[model samples]
Target: MCAVSDDVQISVRKMDMRYRHETLLKDLNFDVHTQDVFVIMGESGCGKSTLLRHMIGLTRPRHGDIFYQGKSFWHCGPEQREEMMQHFGVMYQNGALWTSMTLVENVALPLKQFTTLTRRKIKHAVEFKLALVGLDGYGDYYPAELSGGMRKRAAIARAMALDPKILFFDEPSAGLDPINSKRLDELLLELRDNFGATIVVVTHELDSIFSIANNSIFIEPKVKSIIGRGNPKKLLETTDNPKIIEFLTRGERYE
Candidate 1:
C-alpha cells in the first residue's frame, strides 16, 4: 500500500499560461489534496481545461510551477515525469479510445504497456474495471457499437486500469442524457468511496457539480482566474460576484 502524506497531489503556485499573447490562466494558486473530489467549474473558455492540463504536466506554464507530490514536474527528468504520471489517471471528454480496439482491449492496453502482468492477469483486471463502470458484458463490443454513455464508461474503465491514486476527469458527463449523467456522478462518488482515489473534475454541468462536488473552484470568465474556492453550496450562498451567483442559480435572475 502507498503511504499518504500532507503533500499536495496536484499543486499550482502562481501559475500562468499564455498562447499567442492571450493569457489562459493567470496567477492561479491552489492545492488539490489527497482523497478529495475537487471540482473545477467555469463558463466555457475560462481556461478550466487549461488549468487541468497544467495540473497533469501536459502543458508547461509560461510562469510559476506545478508540483506533484512536492516535486516540481516542470523540472523533473523525463523518467521521473513518467513515474509521476503513472500515479494519475486521466479521462478526456471525448472518451479517447481507439476505434480499432474492443472495449476490453482498450482497457487492458495500459496494463500491458506499464506493467509486466501476463495476458490472463490483464484480462481479469480489465474485466474488473469494466464491471466497476457498469459495462460488465460490453468488453467485447467495439467503440462504435456502444452508446455514448457506454463509451464513456469504457473510457473510465480504461482510466482506472492502472489503479491510479488521482483521477482527472475532463467533462465526464458531456453529451449524455440526464439519466446517464446522473449515473456517471454516482459512479464518480463511488470511485472515491470505494478506491479512495482523489478526483479532480473539470465541468460546467450544474447537476453534476451539485451532486458530486465536495469542494470546488470557480474560474471567472473575464478575469480568466479562480474567483471562488470552497464548498460549492457555501460559495454560492455567500458570494456576491454576479457571475458566480448567476452560475449557482442556474442562470436565473434573483430579483
Candidate 2:
C-alpha cells in the first residue's frame, strides 16, 4: 500500500489501456490533489473519457493499477472496491438523470441503496443536496419537466447524495449554453470551496478549462498519451506545440 496523504486523493501510475490490439492510452501517470479542480482535456477519441472511466473503476486498465487513497483498487477484492467506490461521485456527460423519477427521488436513490436511513431522513438529505446545486424547490419535477441546465444541476445533486469525497464530471457543460456553462463552472468552484471535494472534470470546452481548472492534463491523440500537465494558463503561455496553441486559442487567429 502506498502512503496516504490528505492532498493526494487519487494516484495513477504507468497505466495502459487497450482493446484487442488497439492501444487507447499508454504509460499514463497522474495524481489528483484534494480540493483541487483537475481538468482533463483532449480532442475527440483521445481517450479523455476512457481515462475518467478507469480512474472511477468503471473500467480496469489492461496493464496498470489505479490507486485510491494509496490503495490499489484494481488489485483489491470486491468488498474493498465497494469501500473505495463509496468515496466517489460521478456525473456523466449527459447528466443521466432518470426520466421516471422526480428530482428528489433521483437524488435520494444512492442513499436508499447504500444507507439504512429512514425516508424522512433521506428526504432531508436529498433536499440538502438539491440546495447545494441550486435546485432547492424543484424536487418534485421529473427529468422531462426540467430545462437542460436544470437537468445538469439535478444530476449534480444526485451525484452528491452520498457526500462523496471525490466528484467526477464527464463534460458537465456538454449541452448547455455559455451562460449555463459558466453557472456550472461557478457551482464547481463553490463545491470545492464549501465542501472541500476534489473534482476531476473531463472537458474540452475552452471557457470551462480557463474558468475553473486549477491544474490540468492534456491528452494528445497522436501520441495517445498526455502531452501536457500544469496550470492551464501556464501551459497556454509556454507551450508552442501547434496543437496545444490551437486548443488554447481556439477561436482567435494565431497570427
Which predicted model would earn the best TM-score? 1
Which structure among the candidates has the greatest lDDT?
2
lDDT by residue (tens digit), candidate 1, 1-255: 123357457777888888668887688888888777899998887888878887787888898877777777877797998889998999988898999999999998889999999999999999998987788899899999988878887888888889898999998888877877877888888888888889999998888888788889999867878899987888888888888889888879665
Q: Per-residue CA lDDT of candidate 2, range 1-255, in tens? A: 656576788888889987567898899988888888999998887888888888888888898788887889999898999889988999987789999999998999999999999999999999888887778899999999989888988888888888788999988888787776787899889888988899999988888899899899999978888899888999998887778888888837455
Candidate 1 stretches greater than 4 Å from native? 1-7
**Cα lDDT listed for each candidate:** 0.85, 0.87
Clashing pairs in 2: none
How many clashes does the backbone of model 1 have? 0
At residue 231, give the lDDT of candidate 1: 79
Per-candidate TM-score against the hidden true structure: 0.92, 0.92
